[model samples]
Target chain A: MASPRPRTYAEAREVSSSNSELGWWVFMRISGLLLVFLVFGHLWTNNIVIDPATIDYDYVASRLAQPGVRIYDTFLLFFAMLHGVNGLRYSIEDYTKRPGRRFWYKILLYTVSAIIFVLGTMTLWAFTYQEMGDAVRAIGATQ
Target chain B: MYRGREGQWAFLLHRVSGVAIALFLLLHVLDISLVMFGPDGPFDAFLAFYHNWPFRIGLLMVIAGVVYHALNGLRIILMDFTTWGVRYQRQLWYGVLGLTTAIGVPVLWIVVPQIVGGI
Candidate 1:
């Protein structure tokens, strides 16, 4: 074998990941900032824009009937839920130390979070103005 | 003194409060989405149940959760950008806490009594 060539053919070494914790941290900061606007806008409209007393089925029906409101509400649900879950995930990760136990704990955490996320989304989709109206009529019928 | 740093505390509170608020968001959205079914039906029933005292306070807690989550979140972002070193951390957390209280007071003023009165 010719003595190690000037252009040595060395095996490439893969670098390990660093700053994983820092990356999550940056995410929290960015997500938190966006939440200020989304969350506040949601409250201003729901609680402040219209009086809560006026918030009957018809009121919400009209709100969801609008494309803009629907989109906005969908966004609020999507981002806030995601942001919240990620934050919680970080919490569980930080606190649970043992590798095997931590793995199980994370699985549990994700399962619960996923359930809530699914149910919440389904609830949003089930929004039905006509259904609300009929349900109102049925309630009145009983009286 | 070895006080927990500001950015770290803010991070902690933001996480805790965010979870609380997020849970509330799920429930609140579920509650509001009921109106899509119209005002007169199960929607009213769903809301009417919360007219009691305990539920009202519970709702207020939700509001508090929102205040804590949002304000602390803002602090985290600011500290992320600015050079808020360890020494200044506790002060920053206190600052956020004050801001949260300031914002929360008015919300309580409006939301609490209404819930208490079964609104």
Candidate 2:
């Protein structure tokens, strides 16, 4: 058995440009830039501007209750998961030598990613502050 | 994979950090989503558990992963788009390392104290 030659940079780019690979490549760059801003802003808000010590269940509930916060989080969740999932797919493709193995690996990845996304959406949007009020109060009192 | 050149190492680190961050995001989304289940549900319990020193250290690691992944990701984007980027890829990798260290040290400094202080 002989080792296969790797594609040259130009060859790889040419192939990518002919298919959805180009779109994903471009997406990684654009989404990467967006995530830098979104994730940092999220961290700064949660960790830097507000004291980390104050981040209890009540704090999170209150924050999530606001439409603005939920919207921001939705975008964050969407972008982060998509970007990360795509990156992982790229890695799996690179490392998985067998076609059958790669097929199953991607099936698992996509299935899990989809489930997470759906669960995340439901968690973010399904409950109202009124519904959460008692629990929030209970948690806050304990803390 | 075997070579230890700066570019090679940077690429390897970027991939590893990216995967780690992604896995963490999965857990994060699932955990935070517990909020919708109920305000005082497992989510609150999880948040309380997150207050421990070990968890704080884990968070520090997450921060480190984010810092490196973001910077190196920027480098990768630049290399892909700019005309002269490939020519200077090595230099860019070095810049990524330098920036990661410069930013990472201060981040750890600020975060570690808060964690240790039981914040």
For each candidate, give its TM-score against the true structure. 0.71, 0.86
Top of the candidates by DockQ: 2
Query: CAPRI verdict on model 2?
Result: medium
lDDT of 1 by residue, A7-76 (tens): 1112101121345644545566666777789888877787655546546655666677787877777777
lDDT of 1 by residue, B2-55 (tens): 365555566666666766776676577567555544554478788766555676
- Looking at model 2 chain B, which ten-residue stretch has the lowest summed lDDT? B35-44
Please report the candidate that would top TM-score against the real structure: 2
Question: Which residue segments of model 1 deviate by more than 4 Å?
Answer: A1-23, A49-54, A98-101, A118-128, A131-143, B1-12, B29-42, B84-87
Q: Candidate 2: DockQ?
A: 0.51
What is the per-residue lDDT of model 2 for residues A41-66, given as tens digits with 9 covering 90 to 100? 99889876765765766787888878
TM-score of chain A of 2: 0.77
Q: In candidate 1, how many Å is residue A38 off?
A: 1.0
For residue B57, model 2's alpha carbon misses the true position, in angstroms, by 1.1
Accuracy of chain B in candidate 1 (TM-score): 0.76
